[model samples]
Target: MKTGLREKLKWLRKPDSTPATADNTRATEPDRPGWFIPQKAESLLATPLRRQLMKIIWQRTSVSAALFAELYQTPVARFAVLAQQLPASEYHHHAYPGGLLDHTLEVMAFAAKLRQRHLLPAGAAPEDQAREAEAWTAGILYAALLHDAGKLAIDMEVTTGENQLWYPWQGAPAGPYRLKYRKGREYALHPVAGCLLATRILPDSALNWLAQYPELMASFLYCISGQYERAGVPGEVVQEADRASVAQYMGASAGSVLDNPQPSLAKQILTALRELMHTRYRLNNPQSGSDGWLTADALWLVSKATADNVRAWLLQQGVTSVPDSNIRLFDEMQSLGLIIPTTEGKAIWTCDIQATGGWSPGRPLTLLRVSPERIWPDADGRPPVFDGRVSPLSSVPEQPQACGDAPAMSPVDPGTGTGGDLLSELTLSLFSGTDDHTAPQASMTPPSGSEEKHIAGDGLLTVVPAETESQPPPVTEVNPPVPASITPPVAACSGQNFTDWLREGLLTRKILINDRLARVHMVEGMLFLVSPEIFKLYVQSTTGSTGDEWMLAQKAFQKLGLHHRGVNNINIHTCQIRGPRRNSRVKGYLLTSPEQIFGESIPEDNPYLSVLEEGSGTAT
Candidate 1:
């Protein structure tokens, strides 16, 4: 064997020097700063949750514990020490004491599971793949663990009890430390910052092993550096795993393997609305002000108030993924079929409100109209409907008649007793199997090292089952039939069709622009569509295409000649995203003319974004 491979084998076989006893190895108690003192790899892995996760990782690798210890455990120990009770975000997923560590371990396991589905070095021969399998697996695990390490370096300000600022380069803090997120931090800079600390967390031996494989090393660098658009399979697996961890922590299922699906954001929105209605929202109040009016046909909510409340409520409940902009939230709601759209397929409705008791707004108020049946499925559980009628000044566009449309409620007739029984039957039909209550958000507190098992079976820290371990029955075969009206029709697939669809979706607010989650942004008075993401979304929605099919769509779109080319005639352009604390670069395609996409009247340019000139930076 070559010296390098021989050395790696020797390193993997070396026995751990630390004792295996939990009491001796694990720092079961926190210090004065409420941070666990740095412990050995075995000690850090002593917790039930971490141990369970380590077992899953081992199962995925099918490797001996000694090999696993050298490759996985050592780096994870370093990461845990560096992470030290830091929350993943200010108020997002895994936002609690020691959340960063838990999230990282989860991602490592999840990524391992996801990695089993693929043959690495992408197009390599089977023999080559088999030979390099262990290297690729290690690369994936390292990539997953370090993916968010940059957040600790850049996004936060960590201080020791002596008021000393601690950097990740200095290694884990020598003593107790506290951290606070920097104000106005650039959202996209952490990935770039993470690249700086990769060498610190990963040992030199592992790095040297991975460096032998050029393609794997390149992909690993791209992934840890946060340029996922160029990272290929490694990037995709890590990102999917990260999303799954975040989804589960935020009380949602990570939908589908291989496909990057949007988490159940709509369900969370509806759940928030339901909670607010029960606790804080005042509906149909006569003597005092009301948040909304519930009528026989619809529930008309004040647009601005409803948006603000829902956004706040979701955030408080640990759903930090909610859009900051009301317009984006409204667009999401409408697109997800949670709210009835206006005649022009808009989310907001201009309406005049006049109560029977001579209470009326001075001018028309913008509102959101929701079908009552959506909120109150059981008639008996619903509050009394408004005595006064809610007349819509602007009518909603009629949808195509479908078998799934809820039977329209007839005029309430007390003598005949019609609507109640019908609504009860509809309630049973609509929500037969689903739970009415929202899944509890994961706890912010880290699981105790001493605990043998999770107390709550369905708690926030619930372990997501490995996909490869078992194949559940097909959802369509097992689950009850879903109504067709809820699922929107897929647009015809083509490059021209995609552009046309984009233009129309933007115009109609079905596709959002200039928001945090938005794929299309206005830059230099032209449209800057984030590459691969926008294309992947189009292909996924329309035809569920993967791999080369996505590339074909991009090439097809390029053939249209509507996009501005970068240096070396590259189709991708880099834009500098300037924020208060720092700046970051994003890769995307710049349209040649705003008029081509948005016609004459284009939206204002996103203030934070500026298109970089050709040759300004690397283009993917």
Candidate 2:
């Protein structure tokens, strides 16, 4: 379908909609221009590759010029020049020598465009920005010029099966028989090698900085390797620009007809540019994970709800599909407030505090009065008065801890009972009669032993709704002076051994796979393996894994028992806790695979910490 600039702009204007068409097109085309472009590519093949590299470099601080020059060597350039001079066959897309050069130029052009957009004119040369722009231009240009540089050093031969070619870098024929060899065996490693070779030549060039910022370099190469998927928007632009340029030339030369409208191309260019902007912004202002940092939930409430209902209003506008996890938390000070409905409707909302201590079960909480100059205490001490909204309640019950026997706490299914509405019930819990209703209260503690790895231990301590009707006031004064020290089981593990580490890792985060093995991936610590038997048992008991395959595997593992067979060890490096996979040994053995478990650093936002007293008992 033909989409107009107005229609495309309409989607971009809405955050909830996310403009999938724009994003997808930006991700796929390489000839599209960008808001930032470092330099122009000398050739078509070079454009996509250069575009991809520029996208990557913009992710981090900055790139150096010395490092930029190193991406392409003379020999590689010579080869590309030769390739470009050759006549392309009907089946060969980029089979000529200069193909690499063509891609490199396009990437450079896109990057040049992007640089012009973000950086100021006064800082354009020799300075870091200039060097960054230059080096970025150079590196991408090099990646484009050399991605297929090895092709110049090889030859293609048509055979019975399919077209086969030989590559000098891989020492194998890139032909019909071996797709990997033809495409580039050690395909993932070529860009690295290319960068190294390019560096040797341009020792003082801008790209040498890439060695220091490897992720940026890697991200650039990865985009091309995925051909765009792995590459974020900036990277995608490189790809899109390269493709667009080639398609334009190819169609022009062949007199081939296109089924699409010309405006589609412009739409694609704009989308890629937007994505590039989004990616750079995210990299520049990453979510902070420091002490006194805002929790994701709290941040969401403050930013989205109270901040002029910007979030809800945006959501209603079909702009973004932000999940709850994207929310953040803050421990700063502000006027006391409660979340009450704006109207008599059952819907509840957060609002400023009109007075302290007036909470009712069914009645909706509401207060529109703004307290802009309210003083508040932060984690450190009295900072300044915060103009923002504070959480209605500082403490709320956390999700269930992973006690081996604790039944998974399942909220009513969204599809069932009033669409799983809990406004009335949750509101009652928040306000239950009180004079201190505006103050933050301690969250109900999870039962002790809820985090125990084995079920044989005493049953976990849990909070069932209090059966009695009478209760104390809900609110506690704001920033009530810091309390005396309280020992928490989780806190005690600061200097623990491997077993303790394993327990903590498993209990805190959801299970993840590493190298096909099942184990919990930690954010900043070593990966640990709970006994596979216990792991399996826990999964079955908690409904962590489902389906017939999982159920059948549970039965087999049950039968297998805890006895030491050939596979007793749960390699933390190889463990995986993903969904069902085929088992060659036993149809439903449910064994972990090597690819499933990639090491993940421990999460900064721990799920085990208690919310009641910032650093109270752990395993809440």
Candidate 3:
């Protein structure tokens, strides 16, 4: 029997119901295009992480931009539309307000990597195998992308920006939209929804091509319908990819056995810390009771206490598969740059933290001395250093710091649960996809391209303004305030704030203005902010959304009356910095007062900055 030819799929189980069909034709304009804040898919996909995934797809399938459009791009565009800002799960891995897009992109990447291993037409003639390779590759990518497509059907009531309840059966929702999860809704039935909506997104031409391969077609359909038993390799691959994706978010090895010594894990320790600081955990509480304490220059936490607290919180939130051991958890945290190391370069710091009347004799604590800006934007009033001495642990706890021992989820049995039904979770834990008896993954060789390596001990390679620490409530930049004055209450992404960040960067030594090609520098005790370079930094910090973002920032900066213009009626001044090859002009602002940013103790002028006088053309 031809797949998708059935009047109604057995899985969909709605003989009387019509399947949802989106207009596969691309929309020239979306319904209510700018209803809510629009997240441009092109921008979202252009991020460093997604860019790598797209590159992987192109490499694995040898897909050019044209070929990708013919096969995958159309549906991807549609998926992005319908699922605008829709999260993957309500309380799971990507439980954030808008995590669906990131999650979907991840699974597709995993599936693409998995697709490279298999020979399509598994046991067919060599000629047939060669003929269907691209088709097979396309099938896997579409299946992975569509795996969670049905999520919109049963899980939530999604509406476009205009308050229309757009249904997937009708096609991708017309325009701007948001989603709220359904209470007491059946979670697993979405696989059926995926089947109904798959055709709406997958172009008819691609389907016609896929129909030529029966085994591949059947397996792909079964996986879409949430039937792994029949999905065979496709289903298994999706299952593993899903688990691996979740593991990456959970900071756990993707899939590991309870008794096994080694496991494939996902690493997002820094993202996790970021999430905690933003949503759940609180840091630097000076009060008697708090999650952790913040000092003059560092954040201090009880080592075992924080580990236990994080583990318990993750488990409660349904991230059941995580680093089971405190040591492993600490390893990820330290590696992700989330925690500070001791003087001896150890994750666990032996420090005696004293808060008021209570003090631990000397316990093994975690000393995390991150920048103040990282945890809070406008935090003020630095507290004195802890009044205590370093001592040794006087006693061992009952479990000695609950490492991997939280109520961890067990590895899922693929055969036991239905793929689409959330009647109960399928339980694809850390060790689900890699069974010893399973067929080997497609390639053993690491691809020529690799992800950017991060030495969490080090920081971001790019110094964008948005990533800068210590943005407080904006205040008057009109007069230079002392460094100890107060945190301003400015919009974090504003141009004025960008200048403020430059000032703070100078103060904290986070930015190197003295270096050649630096955007901001001090010259003649006045703030010199390089024009386009500094603006680019500001745009990147605010939104990596558009190429034109900097133009807006430039306009915003001009609105701030900080720069002093010369008699030429130009606030921007050109300067000549000498290099071995030649001399070139760099344009920036000369702040009216250094006290506005540098405050009471302004630094001396940079001897390297040679400001060009009005009407001065070439450097002699």
Candidate achieving the largest lDDT:
1
**lDDT, model 2, position 24:** 10
Winner on lDDT (1 vs 3):
1
How much does candidate 1 score in TM-score? 0.46
- TM-scores for every candidate against the unseen true structure: 0.46, 0.23, 0.40
In lDDT terms, how accurate is model 2? Answer: 0.28
Which regions in candidate 1 have their CA more than 4 angstroms from the true location? 1-8, 11-43, 254-620
* Model 3, runs deviating above 4 Å: 1-35, 38-44, 172-176, 253-620
Question: Which residue segments of model 2 deviate by more than 4 Å?
Answer: 1-115, 118-131, 147-166, 170-207, 212-215, 221-234, 252-620
Pairs that collide in candidate 1 are: 442-460
Tens-digit lDDT track of model 3 for 101-163: 667766776677666667776778887777677778878888888888889788878776567
- Best of the two (2, 3) by lDDT: 3
Query: Against the true structure, candidate 3 has what lDDT?
Result: 0.54
Better of 1 and 2 by TM-score: 1
Q: Which ten residues in a row have the lowest lDDT in candidate 1?
A: 474-483
Residue 552 error, candidate 1, Å: 26
